[model samples]
Target: MRFTTPLSAITLMVASVKAAENPIIGLVDRITSISQDFDNALEDPNPVRIIETLPHLAYDGANLVATIVSDVTGWKNPLDNDDQLKTCATLKKFATTEEKLLTAILNDVVKVATLPLPIGGLIGLVASALKEAVDGIFGFSVKIAPVCSDAANKDKAALTDLIANIKTAI
Candidate 1:
């Protein structure tokens, strides 16, 4: 493929780059979906069922956060100051529910441990869930830490505090 003009080639390159970058437009919606999922997962009365759902949700949540952080760091249509603040606000709200789910997982582990008769495979299942939860939390924090560390946004103070709260939550 050969462009007849340098300007056309440059235009095409810029267009492709923009298309490849993470779409900031739907960030809040994705965050909202994850947050809602967390809430729904917590409503389950069965501890084991809750444990089963949490790891998958956390994985999805962490991946979204990682994608956003990557876009911000790579200078690929980074969120504006207002959008950054909004994103953090949504995240802060999400963190509370996340903390609840994490806490529930811990409590479930204890409950399973104290059962009179150990159900076959229950221990292994709980262990896998715990491992996945830890991995997801670590991945999320690692990505979010960079966003907080880079002080380019006007909402750095709030963002930093929010990130700290999130880190503590899990």
Candidate 2:
């Protein structure tokens, strides 16, 4: 009975530790999933499918970015090397997806523009809005890449200044 009690307690402790995962990793993963969805939508040949996917992607992607940035600002502990690399890799994937999405949207705009004025115009507006959102996210990823990569390797001054600038911007 005594041995069984200790084993059960250890099991509970392990479960609790696993449950308390790093929030940033989860946020990055979610954003990455959104990014992949954007990629898949762009890859689809059906224009309707692409259009249908845009609103959800825009809303979710923007919110996720905001959430991640907010969480990062609040984080006090420095990430270990493994986590730092994982985060940077995911961010790179996200930026790449955004870049691809922007290019695809531009191509789609050219294709859709030949339609009659009203429908074409509406699509153009949606495309523009999506592009704007992608631009914001892409620009953020580009700006942060260096800072994120240098997180563990570099001195604190650069990262500190970046956080201060972000807080001011927010």
Candidate 3:
């Protein structure tokens, strides 16, 4: 096939279509759903379930931060894919915002979960309730590829800090 139109015109069209289907959109959707879940979980009057849930939630949040960082900063072939480059920037901005929001939710949940409780009766109840609640609210299905380096990427420092804060809060 010979180029009937300019080569750049075809390239732009293909890239725009690919950008519309970027996988980052799926990640953003998951993050949005989970963020809303975290908000809803916090509204529960019982603190035991929230206590059990935040640790797993924080673990999953770490995976998201790692993937978001890798997607934005790990591109070795940025020039070869305009759609990836464009979506990388968009995803980084959006994921960072959600990360902060989720961190705030975890922080508040941790505070409530830590409040002093009567020693005997509710303690056993808290333990039993937590075991059941873990599977209900804190599990995630997405398997984010681990970021290659444990060393801090300067570009992803904010996410790193948020992940750490979530861990601490939980």
> What TM-score, to 2 decimals, does candidate 2 have?
0.43
Clashing pairs in 1: none
Over 4 Å off in model 1, which ranges?
1-23, 76-170
Global CA lDDT of candidate 3, please? 0.43
**How does each model score on lDDT?**
0.43, 0.45, 0.43
* Candidate 1 TM-score versus the reference: 0.38
**Model 2 per-residue lDDT tens digits across residues 1-170:** 01112443454355346424533334434433554454455456777766666566666655655654565456556556665565566555545544454445445445544543233433433333333433333333334343474432332233223323322321
Off by over 4 Å in 2: 1-25, 32-53, 117-170
Model 1 C-alpha lDDT per residue in residues 1-170, reported as the tens digit of each score: 11113443454455446433323324433443444454454455666765666566556655656655665465534355565564455445444544454445444444444544333243333233333333333333334443532332333233334334333333
Report per-prediction Cα RMSD to one decimal: 13.3, 13.6, 14.5
Backbone N/Cα/C clashes per model = 0, 0, 0
In the range 58-78, model 3's lDDT, one tens digit per residue, is: 454455555555555543332
The top-ranked prediction according to lDDT is 2
Which candidate model has the greater TM-score, 1 or 2?
2
Q: After superposition, how far is residue 108 of candidate 3 from its true place, in Å?
A: 1.1
